[model samples]
Target chain A: MHDMMIPFGPAHPALPEPVHLKLFLEGEEVKDVDFSVGYNHKGIERTLEEMDFSKSIFMTGRICGICSSAHSTCFTQGIEKLLDVEIPQKAKIIRTIVFELERLTSHLLWLGMLGHEIGFDTLFMLCFREREYVLDSLELITGKRIVHDINIIGGVRRDIPPEMIKKVNKNLGILKDKVDYLQTLIKKDPLIKKRTVGIGNIDKDDVEKLCLVGPVARASGVPYDIRRTDKYLIYDDLNFKIVTQKDGDSFARAIVRVQEMFESIRLTRQALTLIKPGLIRNKPAMTFTEKEAISRVEAPRGELIYYIRSNTTNKPARVKIRTPTYANLMCLNKVLVGNNLADVPVSLASLDPCLCCTDRVTVVREGKEEIIKLEDLHGHH
Target chain B: MFHAIVDCVGDGLIVDKIKKYCLKKSPWIFHFCTGGCNGCDIEILAAMSPKYDFERFGCLVKGSPRHADIFLITGPVNKKIKSRLVNLYNQIPEPKVVIAMGSCALSTGIFQKAYNVCGPLDKIIPVDVYIPGCPPKPEAIIDGIVKGIEVLAKKVK
Candidate 1:
């Protein structure tokens, strides 16, 4: 039997994002899969090198639009560590609120996309419509919908007024009801289960071997959420159980994300109740010492780690970001093989691969183009 | 300029008028993210929601460039995707409008100093509309698409 190779994206109907995957099939039975992604690279890591420590926080926030707070918080935590300054309790709670809200929005968006992927437009509309509540709440609290540049080095940028808290609570109440409905649909819907169950199966050993993070890992029964392991920010005080599922398939991934939203909502409510007015940020000295600091945050997708090396000057010496999606790419490949061609798109989307964050590290210097033999590059992916 | 180009290219006035009319009504858009973060992309998706449904205005987010009338491009145009960007642009038919959807597309936004990105999208392709934000809000994105339809209507047949 002859083998046929099928290509899926750089830009395809099922994928809203950009990623290229090459699947080798032997008459509809997949033998192997290869994927390469440099399409979304913007080289933000190199740009961070030239910016001041505080200014870079905003830059980091843009590293992934969905997880902006995670990046900024991770970067600021690193800088705050280097500066040896402790932010007030209010800042920690504020950061937690935004962080969890970002997760809520992200998970909702993912659910909508998952629905859209498998030809269920109704679910897509429902999820996106419900997502507006979270966005509105975020706008009320941080004054921005998508990229809330609230996390600065010493502390957060804004505090939720009593009135704003009430408004956010009201919004969350509405959202919680809608999400509960969606969760029920997700859990009990036979169509969703039929489509996602047993698709993109990755065993526990495969997950561990690939070093996957976030929902993808938890879905595989790995039980390793950075929020619990690293215990940064206010997570040590926050009360929530780490969500995990044992199936290690596409269905398990969706289940993990959906249940985790409830945990995130609970955490947000707790933070809002505990949040008392004091101070948002402490003015740390602009001058930084020569040292390296690394910070990790559980971004909506997975474990987002930031590495920062700073000099005595205001500018950072070097910066490197290890986004969670980048780590999960390997597992994405493993899950795609042996699936029907029709199921390829749904299986791929189930991983929730954020290509935009995965491939932003290009190190070629200005005016120094490194030319590679075109034929030689064919061996890599 | 659109009329003059149509005059030169010579799609008859009656047909050209019909083309312009239909283009303004249902501006089927195809969104592409060249590089940078996905913030602007999410905003684009949000604009499609019920709160700000661009669909009622004939704005459909098409997946393929072949059926698209307007190109909603997010992120900075990095060097790796440069050729692909041009390829997609070439795929769209005539009288198409290109809308640069974020701060990154307008002028490289946050990644202005990145070594990889060649530059803003305009340097690679002709950009008609620019929505300026680290990620412009859904309202702004909707406004930009409306502007794109206007620009598309004005373009030569």
Candidate 2:
């Protein structure tokens, strides 16, 4: 059979985000895959340089809606390190609770999208329906459903009161049961197994070589969670298992995420117990030397790292972000090539590629792709 | 002869009324994200989920622009997507309503000072309804669509 090339959207039904993929097909099999991002680039890194250090935390929170708390927490943690300020214990617990709940919401959203991609709309509905509980809990804590800008430079913005903690715990109790049902449904559903099992298989060596992070790496039998290693926030004080699977396929990734959601529930509940009514924010006096600090947090997708440098002024000298989707994107060819054309969406969705987080800093110039250096990017302004 | 003519005219009027009613009742949506945070896009999806039940209004998010009646746009219009947004706007059939959701769509929101952004969406195409929030809640999105249907009903006439 002659080879044919199919263009899979900068805007396609299978993908809610904008990503263009060129798939070369030999009959029914995908011979090769080429993908291009930057359709969702908003130049956020450069925008960060112009905003105040305090305000930029909120700006970073808006980077990815799914993991807003992750970005802001990482950014704030970096800023705290730069300023040599340690947040209070209460603040630490609050940050951890928000961080983990954000994980639950992000993972649930990913599950729903995975179902939608595989033509299983029922699973999509069920996942989104249960997701409301998490969103409600987030709303109670942070005052917003999607973008919970709860983190500040010194610490968190909102403290979890006793009543709020009780409510959030109630939601987690319900979510735990729903997640259990989802786990069974995912495992027993033959169609889900057929679609996912052995598809998008990534081996342990490839994960290490490519520097994959989050569940994508864990699914390949790598216990490389930054939360466990770095012990950032109150993670070192809490006890939770790093979920992993040996298969390293799409199904393994789903299982890893679903199981991780249970861990998140446990972690949130533990952190809620740890919260004491002392102080939420330290109100650090804004002072800066020519100092740079790096912070890493395990966002729902994976490890999100932020580099923050501060000058004498209130504005940050520079801020750089490395999102998990950017790191996981390295395995796209491994996931897509050789798969059936029909399996492309399901396999790609399994990676949980957040193009919005990945597509920062590249600009198309006069129809030619150009990579802007940090200094040159500043020059543009 | 007069009675027969009256019956024909009455049937034509009734069909027109039904057509207008269906147009107002069930408006198919096409969502396009022009370079902003995924916050608004996800909220749009949440609005369609089981809890919000956006489909009860007979609204469906269509894959192709040709199949769309309401163009729901989110994000700041960046330079790369500016042309494509115009192309998509042109592809949708006439009597369509354009609803720009999110603060970024309204005025470029936080990415206002970014070099890549070319718009608040209105500069590229005329927008009929504006739903503003960093990322508006699902209920607000549904309200905006209901308002857009009103604008669509007027245009259908």
Candidate 3:
């Protein structure tokens, strides 16, 4: 029997971005995989060196749209810390609200993608249909749905208006019930379980070693939620359980996210009632000698960390971002092995991988290794 | 405004009716990411959500250039994606319309100075419409697509 090497991309239909994987196949089972990335190397980190500290705040949000608000908040928080400025309590509550909303939308979007990946178009449409409510709520509050642009240095840009609070309450109630219905449909739906259960199979040991965060890590029974480990904003004031599963498979990952949606609903409700009025943002220090701070926020995918260094100028000396997807991409090689070709898409979908937002896997293989890109495979077959 | 509209309308009820019908139905879209910032991608998604409801107008995002009638290009087209974009544009059948969304795609926005970036989508692709925003509002995206449908119908002549 002849062996073949297939590469999955920096661009693949199964994946939204360009993450390339080179798989060595022995009779259609993955024997080994080499990861390749860098197709989307826009020099984001390098570009930061030239930007001023003030401008860098907004610039960082462009890192990934799905988590733009998180990036903006995290970047500003890092700078604020460097300036030794404690954000107004109102800003904290607003950040929490925005953060949870981001989580809600991110998880729902991932679920829709998961459904679409497995060829379940109906479920995709349904999940997205509910996601619209969240978007509307976001737009009504922040004026923009995807990139809220609400977070700023010292605090948030806008405060929750009185009328908006009622709308938020009503929307949350509707979202809670609709999300519950969707979760039930997802859990009981035999087709989803059939396609997702035991698909990727990232064992507990591998999960820890990979250091993957968010629902992917929680699904593998790692109770290392950054929101818990590194308390930020008003997470300490809120009460919500960390959703997890011991199965360590795509289905488990999916379930964990679905359950977490409920927790987000709970958190959003708590935030609405608990949040009190105060200054949304603080005036930034006019000048800084030389200071650096690192801020980490729990994004929907996982922990989003931003490192900001200011050198007595409006522009930042250095801005570094570590998105959760970067760490998660490291675990892909370990999980892809021994999976059948047919199961590859489902397995890959488990990470809810967004190559655009996640790390690009770069595979290095030796002679007789024919590399196959995910995009090429997706296009061909 | 009426005079300008009448001038643009050109006394063609047949074209007007066809254009209106096309605008109301079958608004095909193409997604281009000039630079690979995925912010615009998510917003495009926001437009598709039940909240924004672009599909009610019969709009669908197609993967292939051939199937797409309207281009909803996101991101700032970088060096690698630049040539591929031209190739994709060539493959798209005639009567195609292009709409550049997001700041990066417009004037390269924040990523303007980056060495790898191919600033402004118009440098390579002929843009028929532009929706300028860091990430344009979802309604703005729908507006761009609707405008694109109108442009495509006009070109059918």
The top-ranked prediction according to TM-score is 2
Give the DockQ of candidate 3.
0.31
Candidates in order, TM-scores: namely 0.93, 0.94, 0.87
Query: Which candidate achieves the best DockQ against the true structure?
Result: 1
Relative to the unseen true structure, what is the C-alpha lDDT of residue A212 in candidate 3, on a scale of 0 to 100?
86
Write model 2 residue lDDT over A241-325, tens digit each, in one string.
Answer: 9999999999999999999999999999999988777988889899889999999999998999888888899888888889999
Model 2 earns a TM-score of: 0.94
Comparing 1 and 2 on DockQ, the stronger one: 1
Point out the higher-scoring one by TM-score: 2 or 3. Answer: 2
Clashing residue pairs in candidate 1 are none
Candidate 1 lDDT for residue A280 = 86
What DockQ score does model 1 reach against the true complex? 0.62
Best-to-worst lDDT order:
2, 1, 3
Please give, for residues A90-135, the per-residue lDDT of candidate 3 as tens digits: 8888888888888899998888888888899777778888887888
Q: DockQ of all candidates, in order?
A: 0.62, 0.55, 0.31
